[model samples]
Target: MSLCLKSITAVFLTFAGTFSAVSVAQAQGANVVTTNFNTVDEAINALGTSTYQTINTGYTETSKATFTFAVPSETLTLRYRTDNTGVALRDDTGALIARFNAGDRTASEAELMAFLRDRYAKDTEALKLKVANTPSDPVAGNPASLMSQMVSASFSNGTDVGPSPLTGGDRARGTASYNHLGISLQTGRYSGPGFSANVTSLPLSYAFALDDPRWAVKINAPLNFTTINGQDYVSGSVGVGLRMPVTENWSLTPELRVGAVRDGNSGITAVLANASLMSNYRLDLKNGYGLVFGNGLTYSKSLNSSGTSYGLSNTINKNGIELSGPFQHQLYGLPTNWQFSVVHTVVGGTPTYIDEWTDVSLSLGTIGSKNGVTWDSVRIGLTYTRANRGVEGLNINFGYEF
Candidate 1:
């Protein structure tokens, strides 16, 4: 059914008492199809019969059915309920355009038409603004950046010089051999504008002397569970390092790691690789106090990161100082070892990375012989970090070595 332009103008004039400037300026160009409807089905059928193309039709629930129609410049939608009170028009982004009720007469057809046109114009302007404001580079807040953050946290944090062959290897004879096995659990959460990441990892490590007291091979395997933007994923890594003692007090290790994260639903994998050189120096202080100074340089890169739709690459440097000493009093009839460590990241990571964080850790634990072995230790620690890009995190870590 169609309403005449003269009738629409008359109805507006009667209710408004005077034809305002806006009404006068826009009434002439108002689309008559925006006129009031007796029922919502009438509105939906109207668009279906016009230039709008029907995109889909579906029911949200038993009582509500929705129809969506689109054109090149606009998208229109209508939802019809069993009660016929759900007639509403919406833009593509689900912004409400208009709500219609059966036999409504409070507003004139011209007024309804004017409101529809104004809403459409506003929606168009908003779409343009959103497109202009969206970041063109995915690194700012994309999945790739989230994965990069995970990789950085795994490599940079949770690792320590505690009881490692590079730190306190026994040197009785060239044929002296030792074995180290340990596990570490770490979790971190980071957030920034438009995105966030949460990750938990369990890593197992094993080190053994390579037929020489001062030479060792270390292997690390980690299993990771991560969530980014509300989606969950599983990933893991394998790393290997070789220790070469420079002197009685210093050692160096060169390491390589490979990892992958998979999009479980899509079966796409993002691959990562990192190489690092680590140095450790030990000082035996007087009065049972011990000091360990550690430094590391690393390079990391990504492949098959199209799964995240961005590239990941970074260089990082780490320096840490740690002091450990025996407690003056025994705990539970066992001697306690207390440790404090502070690590600083000298170089930052890529965009959206939490690389340049300073970390502080403190712990108290017991060290004693296990079975016939003379060296065994177990510790629980807490770490706090403030990172680049305003990221902050706290973590609980546990370690055991024999």
Candidate 2:
């Protein structure tokens, strides 16, 4: 009788162990919890008492614990049942363990389940360490330490004029404009030993126009007439740049660019080279008032086209200065962001005219004129940016970033 009882006890224990194993497997397979609340805080609160909870305590919980919570190898889905919207986690530094998304309402149940499983498998202790060392607000941290990069593409078309004689006579001239489009791709590394690079390309398009002006000529006067023809212009460039943090609120960047232009009708071609150095300073003012100052110097040189003696036989040089500033909260009842920028270019060396005749010597009476000339120009613009925090591609950009 005693032997029989022992056998029965053993059998009962084996059955109970098998049942427990199956229950654990089922729990692991489906760990997702559904809630009616749209917010993460509300969902967490709605969890029943049966759900497992881990609370952190001082001496026992180290920085590694925080890090584990912050760094997610895969996306973390936060679902708002109230609207069925969701957004993926985008914390790269493992700093934001708890983030609130007001517009994440598009994740499916299957995707959310996969995200949760991947996150659960990460090293929680390591994540905790990272999060503990990170600041509460990533943006409030050192700007120099933040990594940012951008690229843009644009197309513009405009007309150009040709040369003529000083005397009132028809000259050979052509009007041409090309639709120029370019794209740039860039990546940047921030204050902590960062780096960046970009590439740009522009495709060529062609167009032409003609102009005619009639002038009265006296009889017995020397009749000199010329025809003007328009030539299409095509140009493109690619460049790379780097930035280094000089101080807590200042940074310095240096870049180089190379480009070329071709005029098909006139057989005029040239290559362009440019080098620039820039510095930016950030200032924090009262009442959320902030200021940014930027200054830069650029040198550009144009190499003449081969086999062309009249248009540009030699290289030409141009040097310039640029200044810009941004003011925050400068006006009442308006957007807080405002910016102004100006660029001045000083041209040196003999200027090249599209028509070879413009550079040739013309003797009228006792005065003789040569073709080469020099000039300078200044361009200025202003902008206002509206703040749309936590949104991408929703703000307006009027000027170039590079």
Q: Which one is best on TM-score? A: 1
Best by lDDT: 1
What is the C-alpha lDDT profile of model 1 across 21-52, one tens digit per residue? Answer: 11111123444212332222223224421222
The digit string of per-residue lDDT tens for model 2 on 4-90 reads 111111100001121111010011123422222221222223222122112111111001111111112222222122222332333
Global lDDT of each candidate: 0.51, 0.24
Q: Distance from true position, residue 347, model 2, in Å? A: 3.5
**Total clashes in model 1, counting residue pairs 3 or more apart in sequence or in different chains:** 0
The global Cα lDDT (0 to 1) of model 1 is 0.51
lDDT of 2 at 16: 13
Score residue 58 of candidate 1 by CA lDDT.
22
- Please list the residue runs of candidate 2 whose C-alpha ends up more than 4 Å from where it truly belongs after superposition: 1-231, 304-336, 348-402
Q: Pick out the ten consecutive residues of candidate 1 with the lowest summed lDDT.
A: 13-22
